[model samples]
Target chain A: MPVPNRPDRLFRHARSEAIFIASFWLACTVYCCAYCYMYGYITPSRPLTERDVKPIWGVPSWVFWGVFVPWLVCGIVNVVFSAWFVADDDLGEERAAPIADPGGTEADVA
Target chain B: MRDIWRDVLSTGGTRAESAVIFAAEVGSEPKALVALVVFTIASLGLGVAANRFVGREAGFLKKYFLGNRSLGAFAVALTAAVMSGGTFLGFPAFVYAYGWITALWIGSYMVAPLTVLGVMGKRIGRMARRTGAITLPDLFRERFGSPTLGLITSVLVMFFLTCNLIPQFKAGGVIMKKVLPAAATDWATSPPSDDLDIKVDLDTGYMIGLTIFTATVTAYTAYGGFLAAVWTDVFQSVVMAIGVLILLPLSLWSAGGLAAATARGVHDAGIGYAFGPGAGRSFHPITLAVSFFFMWAITSMGQPSTLVRLMAFRDTRTLRYSMIYLTIYNFIIYVPLILIFIAARSVVPGLSKPDEAMPSLVIKLANPYVAGLIMAAPYGAVMSTVSGFLLIIASGLTRDVYQRFLRPHASEKEIALMGHVATVGVGLVVALVALRPPEFLQLIIIFSSAGMAAAFLVPALMGVYWRRATAAGAIAASLAGSGVVIALYALGMLPIEGTIAARLLPANPDIGPASSFRPYYLLGFDPCVWGLASSLVAGIAVSLFTKPPDEARLSLVFDDGPAVEPKFDPPKREVESRGSEEPEAPAEPSATERRNE
Candidate 1:
């Protein structure tokens, strides 16, 4: 009942993982870039003054929110997903074969 | 203190000019040089030990190139997330000049580990084991049964990887030059007297350093192989972390607390230091922010080096643990660098060269002994990166080109010999070229990294996931991707909007020309994005029009055949059959073969 010419369950796990990660990355990208450009970016016509940017724990408020906070959050997301959500597929054999002679060319036995 | 921002505005000079000026202040104390020497010796010992471990193992090519596919979680994470000298040297230079805007420039690294591993780790590992692939090109060639495709990949890998090494070599020389005796570097620091009969001043220190750096890296890489590269990467990763972590506190203390430093930095460089489109309009326009986000995450996913590490891990557990460790590693290294360098801006106000920022600040704040170890961080990174790249080039020539085509019946010893020879040969060539390095070494590094990502990312993704992918499609994808990026670089050499070539790619609009050569960021997006887009379009479109790949091959990769023994024991005939350069005959009674039976 399986669809023909599609990746098996093992490969599908990797594909799904890739899709999920990509979506998370897209979200982070949007938040960081949008926030930075909106608040941090300065121009002549729409200029920002020193008062407009405030220090938060030594970093500019814009950077604290736009980059630092998201970076911390993304790091957490990576940890959670990798530890819990990511799939664990059978990675096949541990060792191919032992070298019969340590002195000899190992590829000869392959 | 020199006001770098005001200089850029008034003199119409680029930040790069300031970089050249900083190269003059090169000499360091004896303790730092001694520390660098000790680090080098330890790395060399590790390399020899790795070689012995590899020699005692099975399958010289497999053990040497792929470490017999037995790396653990920590080794995988460190090697995969290995940072080049740019992370310490060139990147900090940008931060010193551009300020907090650089945070966004490198922001996407937060997800770099996830993207690099999550995208294709399991699938690529599965395919490599199933097909008995030792190298990246080997994976492609074996999967599609196309020697031509394999050969093209080999050439491209060699070309880009070789280009990638030049800057690293130069960085190694530059760092070594800094640690040389002041007497030797007198020419660099002081002008020759008019009373002298002949004003003969050459950078003797740099030459000596270049020779020493090149010999050390090449010898270890050629002597050992992949195992050496990975082990050294782990060691270097720890050293780099310690170096930066130590520098952070010292720098903050020197600048009188983080808040005061941040305030002073903004006051010194103007509000631009703490804002986007930073001082002198560098990293300008919103599109660039978007472009850099793609450049870091997506482009990194496509790197062959990352792919090679993915292929070598033990299992899913290794993958899972590596992702976890790398998240911690990334946060520890990258986040601190931004703050450390920002604090450094306040501590050392008028640095001649931004590229020299890390070393300059380290010496100024830390004592002679501590400064030496901090310097080791960057120097060790250079050695690890160079050695890693050398092995990749060696693998390309040895497995993909020589054994596969030139001498298919070569003995195991001959194959082993070729790997060593190729590594040394490539190392010497890159070192020789690096002696007279190009003006803009960092830009060249960026181009090569982007070029590799553009060339390999799409074809590789399609190859792993798409059962319908044909050899032609992959070949087209690679060529189109490489072509678009190369063409744009060539176009950038032209005078855009009737301006001179030198001014074409300024990082800051106010600065006349920062670099001699720059990539044409079309529509404010990097060439890598355009190249990647083209490759994806070409790969999918070409495959749709072409004949589907051989049904048997598709089943081998995509189907869930009757669970047989692990693909550990490949028969002798399959190994011999690689020499034929033909569509491989069924090596095992695999899914397709068994179904027919």
Candidate 2:
């Protein structure tokens, strides 16, 4: 097949897909925090302090928290999406190359 | 002075003889040329592999430069580590010459892993995917919505990359001359003699080595582009890690074991405390802390070479892994260097230059072949860094300058070609500049890093998280900060003095010597401090006065939507038809969106 003709369309499609993936990641992260406690894996255990202030001066704490919550959610959603994506690959006709040879010895097997 | 010269002349008829004896006794050059040749070929192979994997015909020039954002953890870590050659070579020398205090501050560069992890890497990856902005300048223009700002940013990047590149060339030349003295003599047109009596001119050696190194790097980088650069960096990083780790134990053994080496160094150089200037009074804990803080802040947040690695990562997950790997790698690398330096000081007292200490120890103390390989460590550092700089400069020119301005409609293939051409052009310019060595590494580091930190750091950080940051503010801040730093330093307002200033810039001294303030000596004063102060003020002041872009428009710049979910909606057919492809169907709408409707 010829390469996608419309660059902007491909980009927009990619972007929209990315957002969905990110949102799903965030949802999963929130779920994990509430139930699984995976937050410990990613963040060092330290009390939040003034020194952790955003590098930009004058940014409010609430604003940072606002960004933080969404960001955390996105991270979780991305993880779940990645797992599903990989699984989808297994279900598809295009088999992944062998893992032993990382240098692309495997090709798409139909 | 006369006696020293007389002793030198009596010892050897010419500088070449002294170099040869020193090189042979120390064993600076040997079959290491084989290793260098092998590494260069491997770099080419990696480049070809990356290009094919990414799909060469992909149309966006940004994807070509950025490897379509499909890079993994290993590639990202290697790229970041290699780009930090400044920290690697410059740190050890600074410690040795200025004292352990200087080294400690420099050593704190390890913080780079955590810093980039917390901020730039994840944000940039998310932003790139969201906006489809291929290069840094593209991101800037898209976020700020101003072409002029993009152009200015591009110029500043080029300047910083050039300055950073010069040192790598110089270091490479230094290694090559040490590794292959006979070849160096032949290249320099010196007469052959048993003693190898040739004049040792630091300037001449630096130039010759730089020319050869630049030529080799330029050839591979120009052809392979980022693919060639990153893969080569990965290999170099591995070699450097192995070489440094191995050299630590071997050199200690050669010096008759770690205990003897430590005792000797202490007897001669003293146990150089991390807080105090061990041999000299150069170390003051407070001053060291200040320098460390500045270096950590500026290098982690501002260095363009490091920032480019963030742009190369495939996703946020890759960034996390890269950061973890880099953090571990840096710690492992630092411990060995510290031990090695301490050992060297004990054994080899009164070394001429700090940069020479590592080489001297390796050659004089270690076995010949091992010494040769160990000395090659710095060569790897230099090449990796230089290639990284070459890639950034080429991308800045091709993607940011040419495609953005000169030829906006150029296809991906054309853009990739231009990128390769730009890499060669940049290498040649840097090679010419490297012909002249500067007075000190500190001068180059402060001048280049401070200039970049002033111009880009505040704007980049604030622009990403703050919706209020305006295009006019970014432009004003960058221009003002860069202009003032350059003008002041050029005028001798900085701590730099006579010969160094003359070498860096040919103008007559505009300010008196007393006006120059060394950052180490001054309290509450340093380039990073002043540069950050000025840029922050300019950026915020300009931003407040200007109206923020409308929310709808601003959302495009600061939205974290794409980063949150994989919302793969096939574009409508009409949108696809405009470009040439048929659009796919839209995926599910979000809960928030459905609620709003």
lDDT of 2 at B75: 85
Give per-residue CA lDDT, model 1, range B390-509, as digits (tens). 998999988877876677657889988998999889888887887665544444455677788888898899989888888889999999998989877776655565556446545323
Task: Sort candidate 1 into its docking category.
Answer: acceptable
For candidate 2, the docking band is incorrect
Q: For model 2, how does the per-residue alpha-carbon lDDT over B39-156 read when each residue is reduced to its tens digit?
A: 5567666766766666644444544566666678888876776433333344454444443333334343344554544355555554554444566776676567666787888888
TM-score for predicted model 1 compared with the true structure = 0.85
Alpha-carbon DockQ of candidate 2: 0.02
Worst 10 residues of 2 chain B by lDDT: B9-18
List ranges where model 2 is wrong by over 4 Å: A1-110, B1-28, B82-89, B97-103, B170-211, B251-266, B270-278, B432-442, B491-524, B560-597
Error of 1 at B465 (Å): 1.3
lDDT value for candidate 2?
A: 0.52
